[model samples]
Target chain A: MRAAVYHGPRDVRVEDVPEPELDGPDDAIVRVTHTAVCGSDLWFYRGESDRDPGSTVGHEPMGIVEAVGEDVRSVAPGDRVFAPFKISCGSCEFCRTGLHTSCVESDGWGGDNGGAQGEKVRCPNADGTLVRVPDRYADDEDALRSLLPLTDVMGTGHHAIVSAGVDAGDTCVVVGDGAVGLCAVLAAHRRGASQIVAVGHHEDRLALAEEFGATDVVAERGEAAIDRVRELTGGGASHVAECVGAASSMEAAVEVCRPGGTVGYVGVPHGLDGGLDLFSFFGDNVTLRGGVAPVRAYAEELMADVLQGTLDPAPVFTKTVDLEHIEDGYRAMDEREAIKVLVEV
Target chain B: MRAAVYHGPRDVRVEDVPEPELDGPDDAIVRVTHTAVCGSDLWFYRGESDRDPGSTVGHEPMGIVEAVGEDVRSVAPGDRVFAPFKISCGSCEFCRTGLHTSCVESDGWGGDNGGAQGEKVRCPNADGTLVRVPDRYADDEDALRSLLPLTDVMGTGHHAIVSAGVDAGDTCVVVGDGAVGLCAVLAAHRRGASQIVAVGHHEDRLALAEEFGATDVVAERGEAAIDRVRELTGGGASHVAECVGAASSMEAAVEVCRPGGTVGYVGVPHGLDGGLDLFSFFGDNVTLRGGVAPVRAYAEELMADVLQGTLDPAPVFTKTVDLEHIEDGYRAMDEREAIKVLVEV
Candidate 1:
């Protein structure tokens, strides 16, 4: 199997790796058809992540199930499926309550099976962790591109919107113009937010945010961004989705949020040593929620939206490349030449 | 008029101060009939608060409206009223949304009233900030004692419960057995929690917690306390009311919360130089909310419950003293001789 392997800083290579096999009764082997290079993956390519060398990279994938073990009841051979980043047992107390991110019987960060940036991969806890794609769009390339993001980024953006208690007619702000931020703008739009403000500096990404349903865009940073959001919303946004996990992004999320509003953040915290300012956080009465999203919980419904053609999140993928040229996808994203890169396996 | 004046740490003197006078058409003068020494007030008494010298020091009070300026429509002279610690103009964007603590047109800390421990307070934004006590409880000493806490402590406790999204039948844990923590126990009880665990070391305060409706008490600190709470509730509590503002207290609140549970905290953050740990906080998926509560927003409803005799919060006042012995009231609370001290004028 050919997979993308991490070597050192700015180095990801496409090389032959050992194929994954079913080790448990609940396991299934998925033939990867579509996957993407995430913003977080850049952290590792740039030597920022502590991930070891020679490890398979990538956490987002959607494909057809080529094989299933005896105990896998929910999904079977020949079925199209989407696997979330985290695998859960589905029966744990946390998993039962829709908090699958904290499931007790699951391995986070693609344990044992490695990652999805490969031709084929093994999936554990198959029944509880995988969602079957509808038959109608199973062969549709455009629909596949739209549905692939539901495994991670789009689901994460949806989690932020829901965690912030964003209701219809709300004024929501999306901080950071990454792929996840663009997805959040779409999520807020579909969730009935009357006004969506996109705050980011990149003109190309912000332009895509507008196409994804952003009602306003503020190309500013830090306090200036907050001021622009406040101006757009008249006072401040009722809900803010902080997609950049930096400390400054968290501070700006708090600053531009209305007094009783909430800020849902899903960006993986990278270099934030000091925590958020509790004094100001307290005074404003802003609610904070959103960690690793419970992607499996929302995958079925969101994928349905894609299949039904109600949501088209494919515009986020500005470039697509062959699996053999996977390093180009990484370089394109790292150099800010692309908003997101789709890798066709 | 005589009021409590702060000269330095542990030095509170009841001396003659100039009578309060209304300076705005929206102002009203409140002749304080009852005031209390708060847990936060101890910060100033212990030289921990940066309050300037000679400032009047107190924040919880309920009294009769002695005079009202021309534009004070919601309250009038001779009307009994309760003033939340922070005064807010009800017309502001935050106020209209029930977040009066962040009102745009008012000072947050007592405004021009100086402090509630004084004989009379000149309340700015009186109509928006003051809640009229019902005529039935006008001269009821017991009701006055119960209602006075609604201005701060009880209201803060309620904020924690509401912020944590405590629903009926939730297993709740109150971290900190102080007045606010005990009040949180009561709030959780009133909000229909099926199981309530109070975490603290003080036997007297723990006993009071049971009286206020805590189903169990864990006389432990740090890890042991979290263990006890998990044991008491079968796993972990669905809602956590963190009434202690210390960093360790915040850590404990996060440590024991069920995945997807929330921690509502209202303690005036004092010794926490470092903020909360976002890494663990994000992983746990625990929502954090509650700052300076919009006590004025919850005051009217909570006071109604007190006046109707559905709640009896007066037992929290373990001691009472006249205005002339106000210093003794502060001393009793400072030394932990009383759970709360009421000062009658």
Candidate 2:
């Protein structure tokens, strides 16, 4: 198997590596057909976040199941499937309650379990992690492209808006123009939000957000963006999605929400030396919900939508590459040359 | 008319003051019959929260309508009524959405409006803020006693549970033995929480919590309380309410919430000189909701329950004093001699 390995900062190499073997009866092997570099991956790629030199990378995976261990009943060999970024034992209290990210037996898609970016990766807790694609669309390339993001970003965006309690006739403010933020706009639209405001600094991404069903877009930053959002939505929106977890962005997300509103925050919290300034949330009666998304909990609904042709998030992938040139995909994402690079395994 | 006035730390004086007069078209004057000294009052009483010397005191008001402005229609002179601690314009975006605490033209029951502990109070947003008791129960002393706490603590506790999304068969954990916390136990009980755990310090108060439907009580504090609660709930509860707004207590409330759980915090966030640690919340997928309780929004439903004899938070009032002895009431509350003091005006 050839997997992408971190050599150092700005260095991700596709190297021949030993294939992952099942270490537990709940495990399964997935031959990666599609994967992508995530925004979080840029952390280690830029040397901002530390990573072991030879550790495998990537957390999103869509592929065909090559084999399954003894206890894997729901999915078997040759089934077209995909797994969420986080692996979990579905029967745990957390997973049963739809909080798979906090599952007691949870682990990520890297290191010993093998990276989703690899040609062949071992998946623990297969019954609780893998989502079998319907046979009717398993060979459909466009459908696979649309369904790929459901394994992570799409579900994450849905989690953000859903946690914020976005409902029909709601005015939703989505802060960030990243793939996750754009998907949140799409999600708010699907959830019947009457008005969607996408806030970001990138013009191209903002345009994409508009295409994703944003009724309004605020390209400004800080106070100006807050002013425009408030002006557009009367006082402020009741549902705001914080896609960028930086303190300033989260604070702005709170500011743009109406009193008693909720800010669903899915972005990984970083650069917050002293955590968050929660006094503002307390004073304004704002709720802060969401964390690392439990994508496995949301995969079925999103896949159904994709299969029905009512939802397509493939537009988020602006570039595509083969497994042999996975390094170029990382470079493009790190340099902002692509919104997201789809790795064609 | 007489009212409690702040002199200094540990010094509250009852002094004659001019009777309140209608100042706005939406104003109404209420002859206060019942008021209570709140846990928050101790902040100013202890000189921890800044206050103007000689300011009128108290907020919870349940009384008779003595006068009404030309525009005050829903509530008129001679109606038996109660108002929330925070005054609201009822028609603003925030108020119409049931977020009365953030009403644009909002104010409090002190200063020119007269303290709720006074003989009379001038209400600015009478139509929006006042909840009239049915004439059937207006003169029922027992019903009035049960309804009075709805003006503040009871409604606050209800807000905490409601925001935490406590549903039938839920396991709820309530932190704090204050009036609000005790009321929270009652609220969670009413919300159909199957197992309610009350975490507080006072054995007597925890006993009251048991009466209010706390199936379990942890008399411990800090990490011990967290451990005990986690053990009792078999991990942690999905609904935990924070009625005491200290950082340590709120953090404990968060710690006791299971992944994807919500911490409904009605405690006014005070003493947090810096801010809060939100990293724990993000990592565990915990939601932080609720703030200054929008008591007015909860008043009608609670009042209905009280009038029907299904709810009674009256036991929270462990002592009673006439208007002339309000200073003594404050002293007793300050010394922890009373869980709460009911002031009969």
Candidate 2: DockQ?
0.63
Lowest lDDT block of 10, candidate 1 chain A: A106-115
lDDT of 2: 0.91
Q: What is the C-alpha lDDT profile of model 2 across B1-345, one tens digit per residue?
A: 899999899888999888889887889999999998998999999999988988999999999998888888898788999988999998988888888899899899889999998999999989998999999989988888899999899999999999888999999999999999999999999989999999999999999999999999999878898999999999999899999999888889989998888999999887676577777898889999998899998888888788777899999999999999998888888988899999999
What are the per-residue Cα lDDT tens digits for candidate 2 across A21-96?
A: 8898989999999999998899999998899999999999999998889999999888999889999889988899
Query: Candidate 2, which segments miss by more than 4 Å at Cα?
Result: A7-11, A47-50, A135-139, A323-325, B16-18, B76-78, B134-142
What is candidate 1's lDDT per residue for A1-345, written digit by digit as tens? 899988899988999888888889999999888888999899989888787888888888788998988999998889988788888888988888888999988675344685789888888898988888777777888788888888788998898888877789988999989988999998999999999999998998999999889999999876778888899998888799999898888888888888878899899986776666688789888888888889888887888788778997888889999899999999999999988899999
What TM-score does each prediction get for chain A alone? 0.97, 0.98
Evaluate residue A191 in candidate 1 and report its C-alpha lDDT on the 0 to 100 scale: 93
Instruction: DockQ each candidate and list the results.
Output: 0.73, 0.63
Model 1: how far residue A12 lies from native, Å: 2.6
Q: What digit string (tens of lDDT, one per residue) describes model 1 on residues B182-277?
A: 888888888888888999889989999999999999998778888888888777876899998988888888888888888888888767776677
TM-score of chain B of each: 0.97, 0.98
